[model samples]
Target: MAKLLGLDKVATFFRIIRGNGGIFGSVKTLFRTDELKIGNLIGEDKYGNRYYENNAYFVGRNRWVIYADKVGLNYDGSQVPAEWFGWLHYKTDLPPNKDPSRPKYKWMLDHEQNMSGTNQAYMPYSTTRPKIESWQPPQ
Candidate 1:
């Protein structure tokens, strides 16, 4: 019955149209080249990033992440917490929260999203004055 009405295709079309699938997300789906897969959610990091895994896919590519930020367009990889990073890269089998051997060091810093191109980007403090003063026209 679903095939007769083409509900699958219709549903996909709507997902793309509604922006739930992203701007080019629909394009990727239409081409059958989408890299992301729906998998069993393993856990969510402190930053609210969700991790997923599906053994059905290849080993290295099986694990995936869904950013916590609703604005997928602005999502960045650096947003992933260090603990989750280990699992995402196959460095550890257990999520950070679940790993018993994981250590907590006082020097460890909290996870911070990448701010390279934004106003929040870090700027080093320098004591040196400007090399060239404001240009002055000949008197």
Candidate 2:
């Protein structure tokens, strides 16, 4: 059914039905599943995101991205680390695997999920602020 809809195999019939198989309409369905053609196994990063390409994009179509099998909790965009960022957006001509110029540093930070607005959010400290504000009755 995905073939008929011109969508990736991971995409469901419901999404294709609802989105009508257009790029703009597919935004809502983005990250919902794997939607790329894998003519070749590119490379994997420490966080386990996989990259693939079909080379069919010559006509400006048929590029794809497949999240690792371990990424089950949910994709929040921040799941994608900086290393794979280049391959994901076609920024580099080589995949991380084939790229000889890729760099590694001792101070490199691990991938961190975006936790803003969530319960595990970051807390800032301020020495001048009072712990509790005085409650005042409105006049």
> Which candidate has the top score in TM-score?
1
TM-score of each: 0.65, 0.58
Indicate which candidate wins on lDDT: 1
| Prediction 1 global C-alpha lDDT | 0.74
Predicted candidate 1 versus true structure: per-residue lDDT over 1-139, tens digit per residue: 9978999878855654454366566555334433435567799877677788889778998898877656445777788887888889988898877778888889988777889999999999989998889989999
Instruction: Let me know the TM-score candidate 2 reaches against the reference structure.
Output: 0.58
User: Tens digit of lDDT per residue, candidate 2, span 1-37?
Assistant: 7688677644544545454346644543354563413
114 in model 2: Cα distance from truth in Å? 1.6
